[model samples]
Target: MSRLTLAGMALLLPGLTLGGEWSGYVEGQIRAFTQEPQFDEQGDSTFSLAFEPEYYQSWDRNQQSLTFTPFLRLDSQDEARTHFDIRELLWIYAGDRWELHAGVGKVFWGVTEALHLVDIINQTDLVENPDGEKKLGQPMLKLSFEQDWGTLDLFALPGFRQRTFPGEDGRLRSQPWVDTDLTTYESDREEQHLDFAVRWSHSLGDWDIGLAHFRGTSRDPSFNPVVNRDGDLVLAPHYEIIQQTSLDLQATKGDWLWKLEAIHRGGLDDPFNAATGGFEYTFVGVAETDIDIGMLSEYIYDDRGDDAPVPFENDLFIGLRFTANDVQSSELLTGLIKDLDSDALMFNLETNRRIGSSWKGALQARFWIDVPREDPMHAFSSDDYIEISLARYF
Candidate 1:
């Protein structure tokens, strides 16, 4: 087929098209701190440049296709934050009732807005953001079957990826930095450890449900204190072998949406159960204006309570979302998470709007309030900062 003809078909058929395209975005960001750094090596401000480019093509009557996407970032202050990664490099084959996906890709699982407790397929790319919204591409071979009963997906992952951490000169870092070189894994194969997962999903009327299980090297690691060459204490990550079962569900009813995510894990000292549930109620065209408002609330619980290694053992999350419904798609989201046991509070604000046809701008701010000395977040009591970014798409 001619290139012009294939392009025309691609526009009409989308996923089942027979053409190639390239697109990406370049962004520049600056973060300004509201207070002095707690550590001497830390700085008051930082700047970064990031780029992500994607290429996609499909052929063979749309039964086969491939996508390649790569990401790169350069940070002015933290060397550990400057990195490169292949976000996706996937080859897929689609059949009448089944599909196969191969290569590196990203997958997400969970329903609650406060926390994605069951998302375990890919490792967290912590350097990108502390929110855990970004993930590193996972190398896997996934086979999915679609049936009347439900959809089933099987995953065979070949390698493990250790979670990333900020360096000594980075902000929002632990008191003692992490020494990744000394990282250890419970699996004999270390990074080469193989993992497996399966998920069954179904939709019934206004409800969607998913049940999944994973067995392999755990993505969440514990820190082991070690003394470095300078006799300074540094934490080394230790990966544990673990098994987890999770269930996620969501229901839609008019302007109200409900979500829940729960998980049972066995790996460390003893088994533990955790859950996060939330609801969002949206008001459309509020007061006869072209604006919408959404109210959200969630509860986070861990059976281990305060003894849990990570935070969010007993917490409550409340937030509000606003949409201007303008031509440029302006939006704002603000949330507050409070430890149920004490007066500790964490607040986050995010807003974004399009500048023009090809340009966009965003702002984010984070603050810690009345954090107790023993809380894990106490280390960042003075790390309040505001971040701004501008991006151009092509």
Candidate 2:
């Protein structure tokens, strides 16, 4: 058993009280997808299942309180392949004005509606490898401050698992595994980093506004560029710094709600070329008509220059989000299509219901189709896929 699982069993061992609070949640999901099933220009289709369980323990009885977070996930498919992943395992410390937290956990960064511009916080958004193994986010160490108006955080880059993704030629790109791979210059390597951030929130009557910023260096080792677009040899560069900022505002007028957020990026030493990082923005508006039905719209824009570190270009998007109860029961059972974008159109249907007091279940299905664009050589431009998933949580 993993260390986190052992800790969780310790909590329920009949007569045990460590003066701490313990909680846990379990989630299992199955997904079926078809990528370019007909056209064949985008990718391939797939069907898979996922199971994840998370546990936490927070101890605050004495002057020193610590928290523990741990999780595990397993994935399987009909292709006779199975994958296992350990998501997060970490310890934390807390204080009054100054709190110290160090652990191996996922972070969520970004604040937008349609897409993530600068939300570099931390969260694993379902990463799947070529072999279909679900890869979780890296672990990290963090320190934060709590004030009357807001909070500030300073964190250390994670030193955990490494991942490989598909390259331009459909080949796997290898990255360094900090713990397993040690070379001749191992002693000279820097294993830690500094991640700085600040977040503030305030409310005026029925309006709320939030602001946050995060800046840090890359933790994972850079991979060597072996092949260029034309099959030529190239070299990959090192990272300097990554800085991002987010501003958000939300106001509720009667039953209507409006939200806006913008993100700005800076301090990049350019990976592909040598230009600085650019910026992205997003906004959302929604109205709740009933308990189960609501209306929503979102927009996103990217303004990063062509020569910047990452080659994401300026694109526009607008989409809607609807629940099953928004339409008739027949339509709800058949699912509803709720998205239209510059490069793609999406059809999605989802349902959620509670089980016992500690359990809940959800089902989701989504289909994406790429709308024809002017250019086919662009890296970020592309196409069609279908994803269906069922999840149970507690």
Candidate 3:
């Protein structure tokens, strides 16, 4: 378990005894590889069990509230994959025109479906998934004001979380493992560095717009090859302080949707700008059936171009989304990203359905093709795998 999770549980114990409501889910996951692992210590299959529970309470005519959420996962193969986190443990106060929030929470900021370029408030939980959808909760004190112009949110982030990486025995990694123990920080205070962010969001007719800025430690890290005390070559992570400005905009017109996320960041080797924009058109009641099909296309661009470390630079993303307007709530999404400057390609498919009143099932698959050695994804050339999971909710 994480130290934050433990501390949160201790602090929220009194709230739990205050007759709060509770809900949660437990799930088991199975991952099967399509090919042999690239490393000798890796395996072809892995299994894990995860649990996430939430507690919530409201008082004072619903103006004050408390929410506590904790997550845990135990992996059978990789020790680094077994971890815990405090997804949310917060207290909120809502008044007529202003609000206050204190504790650990998760915030999402983006409009693009393929890539979330403007989402930088919370660090990515890389061990959970390669898609970078999962995030770690951040310790924050936030104040918000709703005025005639828009909603303004001010955040004071106190603690920073390091990005998680796979272990030596884990899949989807290069030959040399990352030595997290050797992590370095640009700030003298390291993890104690204070971070801050502000955002303003408003809606106008069919358009929604949000602008935000943040300064502090960068969630993303750069790796330097070094020799550990054991005389083994490894990658040491180094965190840099950064300042970023971002924008997310979306327009909804009938069955068509347009989205964009853009960001300009400074504090690394050089300042760079990145953006992802796309459009989705949905065909309602396809073929006179209740199923709806949507076509998605997005363009990803980074000013650094081919030299960027991220794989999505100068790439195109094409996807299809299927929705079954049924009682079971079944949905499917399939997509592929192709590097415009090289042969690197990534194909992904994800689907989920409600099994029963209290059960759900999901499947996810990833494939990499034509990944050249120069590409960062070349390490995952043989890491294509499928994951299946079933969850029981209460």
lDDT of 1 by residue, 330-390 (tens): 9999999999999999999999999989999999999999988888888778889899999
* Number of clashes recorded per candidate: 0, 10, 0
> Residue 363 in candidate 1 has what lDDT?
98
Q: For model 2, what is the C-alpha lDDT against the true structure?
A: 0.43
Which stretches of model 2 miss by more than 4 angstroms?
1-29, 35-49, 62-69, 77-86, 107-111, 123-138, 158-193, 200-207, 218-240, 269-292, 305-350, 355-361, 371-394
Candidates 1 and 2, the one with greater lDDT: 1
lDDT of 2 by residue, 1-394 (tens): 2345534644544333555555656555544343322222212433445555555545444434334444444434222123454555555555777765554556554333444444454532223432122345455557777776656666665442333333222211112111112211122333334455666666678766767766665322343545444554544433345566777666677656676667665564432211112222222332433323344544434443432232224433333334333322212222222222235344445455555555555555544345333321122222222334444544
**Alpha-carbon runs more than 4 Å astray in model 1:** 1-19
lDDT (10s digit) by residue, model 3, range 1-394 = 2455645654664333466789999999999999998878999999999999999988777787888899999998889889998888888889999998888889888888999999988988888998999998888889999998999999999889888888888887766888788899999988889999999999999999999999999998988999999898999989999999999999999998999999999977799999999999999999999999999999999998878878888899999999999999999999999998998999999999999799999999999999989888888999999999999999
Overlapping backbone residue pairs in candidate 3 total 0
Better of 2 and 3 by TM-score: 3
Ranking by TM-score: 3, 1, 2
- Top candidate on TM-score is 3
* Count: clashes, candidate 2: 10
Model 2 residue 104 CA deviation in Å = 2.1
